[model samples]
Target: MTTFLQLHLLTAYPPSNPNRDDQGRPKQATVGGAPRLRLSSQSIKRALRVSEPFRQGLAGHMGQRTKLMAKVLLDRLLAGGMDAAQARTKAEEIAKVFGKIEPQDKKRPEAVQGTTLAFISPDERAFALDLADKALAGEALPTDKELARTVLRTADGAVDIAMFGRMLADNPDFNRDAAVQISHAITTHRAQAEDDYFTAVDDLQRREDTGGAHLGEHGFGSGVYYLYACVNCDLLVENLGGDKELAARGLRSLVRAIATATPSGKQNSHAHHPRAGYVRAEIGGAAPRDLTGAFFTPVRGDDLFDASARALERTAADIDRAYGPAADAVETMDVPKGQGTLAAIEDFAASALERQNA
Candidate 1:
């Protein structure tokens, strides 16, 4: 059983520069016009993946895909009786079919283009392109099979954090998106506090107050946080082939496998010294905390993976209690539910089965 779990984080206090056109204050949107915090969606997602839990669980797969597709294709070509050169060519072709470019575009860095090819094998790439060409020509094609195959092949692939996703999956009451959004909000709130602390503190003032609020050993800021994540078992199965009932069963099996598997742990350590600069607050003012680095001292990859798995198992029990057994079948699995999009998928899968049985 395999599944694709995606985690997204949005800052609660998305910041906005004072709406002043080089003059007096202008009307700004969002809750009382209190200046908002600033952080990109990409930034939050990246941070989550780099969190101790995700780094520990999935490891390098979450960050880099440099030669993944090339490797996939090379293996395929060997299986298909092609020589090294021929295999490479076929792999490139397959990559191209799956939206990966060959020979690297000049405007784009090789690193960026290479990442695209890291996920697919040459044969699958070739199949996908062939499927597309046939569709364009009005020829019968195997779209579902290709999608299913891709999902199956990458079943164990950990491309992102699972903790957040696992939480959403296990707890039917939990809203995955809302959870991520809240996490982002918390980080945003922390970031703003740090920014304010930097603004307020000076060498002379710190000395005046016995260096209490002075920036200490920590360099970047402790407000920064890393979030590890995982998704539910059924969710993964559904994403792979768009099948709900099958996914739910897969999810159950996954839970069993996880129970038997050795647990993983996080490795990254806070980079800066514990005594760092003070953070400004919305009301209570400045306070000191450790400064987590931009990279967060490279936490262990195992921690991230383990956290997600654990979170998912707990979440699953909760979900079953609230949603009951997923009663749908495979085909109509995309319609999402109340933050429980995965369960909604299960319902659809069950429904499909009922129709088939009827």
Candidate 2:
């Protein structure tokens, strides 16, 4: 059975759009008969994947999530001393091995593209690039190219691809199930959507020209939010070609990323990026739980941070009482002023992996 790593986080933001809706307002949902600020799994994962801590830590061990697979391979072929026309033909042929490529068009016939976004890693692009080089040399093509199962094995080296997984509709065999599951962050207390009305004064305008150059209103809200994530160690290892050591490193980096990173949605206008006020890291039964249940009644205390922490403790105790205990190893951290140290959190996460490996 796979060991599961679950992280429970409580963070507070002050009037920021960590995640926004199509209308350019903070995303929200009605919960417990009251509106709660929302942050999608996509935004949360993207933030974590691109976080400086993740980049600095994983450095060369990550993947680029884009549709530039074709372009990437084409560039590599040209650098290998191939002529332009031969490089383009071989590149598209190899690109077709990954996903359906749009036919060459008059607008930009030389450059090919996938039908949609393909979360290909640099390693995968390099692998395809080698294939194109072989095709140029008139070598035999890979018989397995027709089946994506053989072409999509580059997940072994890409941290983001292995953790978040990939989906290729053109070939389901290449799909790698996500080892990590991140939930939408929901506000602990009910909140009302607030507005900020401001105008940009034109730098070139004379004093008598106009009152303001441009005027507009934007939506925002402030609240303490609960975020949850679970990492399946076995699946993570499997995604990385059964490299337990690398997977452990990934989990360690991911914990630091979660503890430090905040979504960069409207930070320029509303710089409200704050880390988790409270964190609960646990290596529990496969059945994972989130403390969103604790806010069912909506915490009503002068100190929402401490109140949220207490509710989490109480709810966790209640679960153990009713469900015969869930955690094998558990640790808690609270930064009431949003200044929690992550040293213990990182050590705790790595210890879980070590224990599982043991």
Best-fitting candidate, scored by TM-score: 2
The residue-by-residue lDDT of candidate 1 on 1-358, one tens digit each, is 2222222211111122211222222221221223322323334344444445345544433323244554555565556565666555554544442344456456742222333423332233455455434433445433433443432232223333122232212112322221122122212112222222223355566444653554523112222122222343334433333444443343332222221221111102222212101110110111211111212222224343233223333443464466552222112111111132333433332232233313
Which pairs of residues have clashing backbones in candidate 2?
none
Whole-model alpha-carbon lDDT for candidate 2: 0.80
lDDT of each: 0.31, 0.80
Model 2: per-residue Cα lDDT at residue 149: 45
Candidate 2: regions farther than 4 A off: 78-86, 144-150, 337-340
Most accurate candidate by lDDT? 2
